[model samples]
Target: METNTEPQLPYMPGLAGVPAAESKVCDIDGQKGILFYRGYPIEELAEKSTFEETSYMLLYGQLPTKEQLDGFTHELVHHRRLKYKLIDLMKTLPETGHPMDALAAAVGALGMFYPHINVMDAAQRHGACVRLIAKLPTIVAAFHRMRRGDRDVLPNDKLNHAANFLYMLNEQEPDPFHAKILDTCLVLHAEHSMNASTFSARVTGSSLADSYAVVASAVGTLSGPLHGGANEDVLDMLQEIGTVENVIPWLDKAQAAKRKIPGFGHREYKVKDPRAKILQRLAEQLFARYGSTPLYDIAVKLESVMEERVGSKGIYPNVDFYSGLVYQKLGIPMDLFTPVFAIARVSGWLAHWMEQLENNRIFRPSQVYVGAPPRSYTSIDRR
Candidate 1:
């Protein structure tokens, strides 16, 4: 690695305890269970704004006026198609593959095609952001079809980002209510300060990697359970319980061992995760719309158990806790849950990647050596 700076400083604060150096986009008041993006509360934005508007605010650091948001939305709609080169590359990957894997590969391929793949120019970086925000959903949805022996779904110029995505998945236009729910899901997922995937993106950006490469790295990290798959695990846990009567007992056993109930607690939020509250409300609305399903009832029971069994101050649901039930209530497929997470979180990832690039710093975090001193090299004959 090239360096003008040498003899790097060490920082070995305990994992899950180290304060992040600084962040420009989000503030996590973990004690209060509050999350704000660019100084705006998630609840206020979720209530009054569209996902597109919120995504804009996160990326650009100010909420757009009606016209500004419209123009931004218009440009996204216009650039929905992937470069032909990218689509062809997608055809080469195995058809029976995870959608996130396919997304990672496709994102990496951008680095191959770019003449300035590692360039950090401002205009080039901005263009990269636009392409990613526009193309990611289509890439994810196309991979969904590929896994099922279907052809790549063409992007729709008419519908907005999230609706067009759902339309591609099912080969039909989304109903207004469902589209709204999905859009809200996108807004909720868009940014969460410095979550796993966003940090990966920022780390890559800090290393001077291209945005696509940064995003590809994010796709890899997001495929993990402890980070992005909480909602899916939430469903799996509910399935294991299967009835309202089972919730309390399940919580009692899990809490007795201090086993995490996937969505029940957060590293930051000692209280209720606000995103969970919003999603829980959405879950209720969907329950009212379509009538209660077993999953919804199970989720409610689990929520009650967490707050009752564990002290409310100690354990409350996080975003991942309620999102799966919301998706279940909306009739979305279970396997699509985490990809849905990616689709929403892409906005925040892009925003942070761009932000990190603007004032680049390689994230070479130091490790504290705690090893045996003066180890001797062993020869093969010594055995």
Candidate 2:
């Protein structure tokens, strides 16, 4: 037998622009700043859909009917309670631990409690998906309260998903306007096709890993600053700018030093991100209700300065730009920003995991070997 010895193809750094899989889950037209899920425009979904409804659409591939949604919501609400052992495990984590770390650990622990599900079975997968969607916010809220030495605020079944999370975190019922804002945020963050974390989920699922393990891999991936953590960086940058007047000078210095502006650019959208557009409008409404924060003013000015400097180069405000500011106004701490992203994005992660199982193939791309090849073996003292 003879092996083919053809030269390897040129390497593409980061596998940019590669088509790893075919998905009906979501689509993005980067140039036009358009995003869609199941062939429906993002704008329409953000305007009309609740996070629960959007989560259903992502997981099941269609918007649920009123009856279906009611049943699904009931299931989610009931499953919000975590096993006591999971809460005990979260307590052992250092208070300084990042929320994403606690979340990944807790999600991985879920497999131990719910061990009977068969990953290959569709019904079992759906059950796991619902549990994860229901429980993540509760886990996040538990860790948040424990870290602050506050008494744990259990989930409120009477409220919707977004509102319940706020109630648990704040230990007070969320105002209707605040709850609605957070719900829209969740809908916007629910899914994006083949993003870093979603790709991580699919890769783990391709190995036939269980749903908990698949989501754990994604949580770890999302912990990276370049992914889900970018919003935290954006908020920090806005605070450092300090005032609207500092925006122009700060942009100049940052550009001169070749420093990156956290939220001013995105790899996918050449124009403003569609989610950012929606969030910007939400920010306006929030400021009107809660009174404007200084950070929001700085963020707006920063965007204007960034546009003048780099707008022609296809750099613009991304989802992270306004999302952090919105979360700040909602009384969320900066560190918890990425964990909130995880809560919303778990729907998408599970969707990709299920999709990967439907057409399972192990991802094994070859690498171009540039190091010494076919070297002769040498004895230790040969030289």
Indicate which candidate wins on TM-score: 2
TM-score of each: 0.91, 0.97
Clashes (N, CA, C under 3 Å) per candidate? 1, 0
Q: Write the per-residue lDDT of candidate 1 for residues 181-213, one digit (tens) a residue.
A: 888888888888877777788888788877778
So what's the TM-score on candidate 2? 0.97
lDDT of 2 by residue, 330-376 (tens): 99988899999999999999988888888788998898766665667
User: Each candidate's root-mean-square deviation in Å?
Assistant: 3.6, 1.5
> Which consecutive 10 residues in model 1 have the weakest lDDT in total?
1-10
